[model samples]
Target: MKVPVKVDGRELTLSNLNKVLYPDYGFSKAEVIDYYTRVAPVLLPHLRGRPLTVKRYPNGVNGQFFFEKNTPEHTPAWVRRANLPAPGSTKNRERIDFAIVDDLPTLVYYANLAALELHVPQWRVDEDGEALKPDTLVFDLDPGAPATIVECCEVALMLREVLQVEGLTARPKTSGNKGMQLYADWDCREEPSVYAKRLAQFLEKERPKQIVSVMTKKARPGKVFIDWSQNNPAKTTVAPYSLRARELPTVSTPLTWEEVEGCERPEDLVFTAPDVLARVEKRGDLFGRA
Candidate 1:
């Protein structure tokens, strides 16, 4: 595939792989392409040809939303962009988090009773309990602090317990960065439009308030937020895998827990074509063809 869009005078290569790109943008290489392919097609119409400014990552985080545009903007960037779900945009943020990839490979992964917690849906729904016989599933985790994968997986296990108690079945994934994402199977007919609000609300009532919320401006070190209300409409959080600007290159990008303690963070990740693709296969996103 050949794409002509350029960040500056630089031209980008289009990789025809089942991978997520723009991991710095919280997407793998293939996923970067997938978004451009799957969600972007639908989003473009909503965007109406406006240029877009994407947040990129290059470093460390104590949580909260942190982003930086590393490179120059596209000449006259898209005026509108698809945003994460925010509060009061709907009844809750649940709807936004519940939808699953409709593609075949993704479906196979979700069907794995053991892995559902990692597959993680985008919304939390309370509609009819009808969705529970789930052809659909999603996993979600709230990262509390620096911990081991064992600890994180335990959190995932706890999440699965929560779902079962609530009558939803799901599987979990490691996220490869930090935290775990769980998924449940369902036949949801709801649109993605209302997801953010519902997700924010669900997060609000579900977790104890964090010491931090999304950064409205720069933040002091050692302070992080657990606030989910920022997921509300008109508000957003940086997508996972998106980079933050850090002083060191290797140390500048987001990493798995094994590295967070020794990591350095200063600014944020700048979105680039290369960062885009890494996130794709990293998440095994193309496992399903959604």
Candidate 2:
């Protein structure tokens, strides 16, 4: 079963987690509806309440499209097929709602809040601090494995060199979780769409061997993954100051490499919900893509 949801007047089909998504994530429509009501208070205010759309599914997303029923006949044409149905949500697709955010705090806050609401396991999006800014171009080197900090930093340096010669304003930040996010500020382009296309083009031409310009599981790191898509004006990536996108019982809390060393494998970070307030308070400039 699926239900109708509206965000800023945009209507979308919300899959029913209990009915459409996975068995583990199943829930009643009313329950999922309640989930949104709570998180919205935490973020919609910060987002300035822009028109938004969220596709709720019961199970895994087949793809995104007009949900039908809830959509107002007067819906904007620009919203048609607003996005590809979110691919990798929980196994239960219907128990979700995507929100609009204007700031990193909201992004982090809402993500953590939503997970708490659903009580499901979630992963953190190790967003590059650089990627959050509109002025710079970012190369997010995401190594899906637990490699050494030295190795990660070395990769950041190498990628930084590539961005420099190309005349892109590239700065590196420790995505504050794992991997790194390299941002390039392009004085040449002001439009986010143009930036994404140009950067994707650049990566295709320069780093043909490594994967570039992909998202979700398509761009997991074994080799370097160049993400220019977050530069898209239509989309947003989490920020360093922004909380690591986490689900309930798990926040993408920051950890020193020393902590990483203590773990048996990368799997250890999945369940961690550290009291990160102290660290967050200490790192005041963390929000600035540092």
Candidate that scores best on TM-score: 2
- Considering every candidate listed, which one attains the maximal lDDT? 2
Alpha-carbon local distance difference test for all models: 0.31, 0.39
Q: What is the TM-score of each predicted model, taking all chains together?
A: 0.33, 0.41
Runs off by more than 4 Å, candidate 1: 1-53, 57-146, 165-177, 183-231, 234-290
lDDT tens readout by residue for model 1, 1-290: 53443432434444333332222334333433333443222222222211112332211221232221111244123212222333353445422222223232332221111111111223322333122221333333334444333443444444555656656554443333434444444444443223323443454356434222343433312322223343222332222332222221111122333332222331122323244345443633322312
What TM-score does candidate 1 reach?
Answer: 0.33
Cα lDDT tens digits, model 2, 114-207, are 2222111011111221113244454555664434333444555556556567665455444445565555545544665565556555655665
